[model samples]
Target: MALLSVHNLSQSFGGLQALTDFNMEIGGYDLVGLIGPNGAGKTTVFNLVSGFYTPTRGAIVFNGKPTRGMKPHEVTALGLARTFQNIRLWNDLSVLDNIRIAQYHRLGYGFLDAVLRTARYARAEKNVDRKCRDILDMMDLTEFVEELPKNLPYGLQRRVELARALSTKPRLLLLDEPAAGLNALDVDGLIHLIRWIYNEFKISIWMIEHQMKVVMTLCQRLMVMDFGKTIADGAPGEIQNNPDVIAAYLGDGAV
Candidate 1:
């Protein structure tokens, strides 16, 4: 079975129709890209699939279960985690603390256990600390564990956010514009890091990226969206040559 499946997905913001009849299926370890011009509803699709917004019409099935009414945290608990287009780190929290907080949903101990400092709470906290450190180390942010996210460089902050998402131990990772503010050097590093993560974790990755270099380098398949609808879906090479995708990005006159 596919890891995730969406059927007839649609969303509207009152009078503005954001997405229409969107459909996609991701296999167990696929790496796919979603691309298009601005306002093409790429992030909207991510928001709906990640449970940040409920779809106006459609069904989302993840790991063989329906996620129609699930909350964002509930979705994360079901092995789906995501990083936002904008960095959403707790600026005041230490890097380690930020990573630690993402695992709160799986603490496996009640408030009473925490208030009383019971064995369960102690064990849970220990495991969380170990996991957070491991993730930080894996992402090469171990030295900055005690530093605040606001104090780090833009690229490091992005890595911290990605590490926080990985701390959730998701089977599918959704990355929205990860290379948005990165410099050329940082973008190169990000491409390498993403490729490493995909191979190392052996998990499915679905990303919305506008950087042609990033998407073309890492994605095996690409889907193009324009004005809330999919215009093309095929291999990256095919997408690059597709007339509809070309027209959507460069004007009909260019086509």
Candidate 2:
């Protein structure tokens, strides 16, 4: 079964139609790329699916349920997670604390149970800590456990953001420009880490990116949009040869 589906999604900001009839289907374990010129509504689509914004019109189905008016955390509870193009982190918190927060719900006990530290509460806390540390290690951030978010370098900061997102235990991950502002080496590391996560967790990924090299390497299928509409969709190789894609990039005078 598909993990996520969006049909006839349309949204507008008064005079600006941000997305128009956007449609997609993502099956479990599929890694798809969403690439297009600036203002292509790629991130807007992510926002709609992630519940950051309610669409002006259309329907979104996730895990076989309607998601037209769900909240962001509600979406996360339904097995969807995402990272923003612009980094969002608790700068005052340690890297570990930031990531550890995501697993709080999995700890199971209510506040009273936690304060009491009953057997169930203790066990749940222990399990959460173990899993959080394991995820940190997976992101190659084991040594930075005690370091504040601001203490980490830019590349590591991005890694921390990714780690925080993964802690949500999502079935479908929407990554918005994950490689943005990353150096060459950091870009390579992100590529490896993302693939490993997909392999280890069996989660599907949908990303909005402009980096063709990374997109082509990480995704099996690619979708391109322009002016809030679907312009092209195909395999990486096919997308490269697509006339619409070429025109969309060139026609917009982007390249």
Candidate 3:
């Protein structure tokens, strides 16, 4: 089944057109790449899907539900989660705390229960901790659980972000520039990590990235955007050979 669909999606910022006639169909557990030049509106599309922006016009259906006007938290509750282009970790919090916070949406407790620390709330909190630890293990973050974000290396910090995102138990995960500051080896680690995420969790992934090495190798399908419009969409091999994508990159001097 199609986990997400976008048709004729268009957005504008006053006089600047950001996205136009964007259409895509993402199936279950698909590893899809959204890419293009620097100003290609890749992150904008992620925002639109995650409810950061209401489209000027279009339809976005996630898991057969309309996403129009829903808030970001609402999108997450509906089994959609995303990471930012910039790492937004709580620098002071331990890595375990980061993932534990993401699971709060699924916790079964009223405000009064939290305030009073009821027995039920205690049990719920314990379960959340166990689940968070399991997620940390999956991301290879167990060793750093007690450490704050500031103490971790850049590459490990990125994995912590993914671990936190996975704590949400999302069916579809949107990753924006997950490999942003990594060196070659770190990027390769992310490629394997992402593939493992898809295979083990059965989660569909859609990502926006400028790193061709990771995007081209990791994603099964690729979508090219230029000037906020999708210019080409196909498999990795086809996209690498496509003249339009090549020209779009070179024309924008991104090559």
Candidate 2, pairs of clashing residues: none
TM-scores for all predictions: 0.99, 0.95, 0.96
Error of 3 at 190 (Å): 1.1
Candidate 2's C-alpha runs over 4 A off are: 252-255
| Order of the predicted models by TM-score, top scorer first | 1, 3, 2
Report the alpha-carbon TM-score of model 2 versus the true structure.
0.95
Q: Which digits, one per residue and each the tens of the lDDT, describe model 2 over residues 120-225? A: 8888878888888889988889999999989778888888888998998899999999999998888898898889988998999999988887899999999999
Angstrom error of the Cα, residue 161, model 3: value is 0.4
Task: Return the TM-score for candidate 1, rounded to 2 decimals.
Answer: 0.99
Q: lDDT for each of the candidates? A: 0.96, 0.90, 0.90
Order of candidate numbers by lDDT, starting with the best: 1, 3, 2
- Model with the higher TM-score, candidate 1 or 2: 1
Q: How far off is residue 231 in model 2, in Å?
A: 0.4
lDDT of 3 by residue, 116-193 (tens): 999989999999989987998878889889999988899988888888899999999999999999999988889999
User: What's the lDDT of the predicted structure labeled candidate 1?
Assistant: 0.96
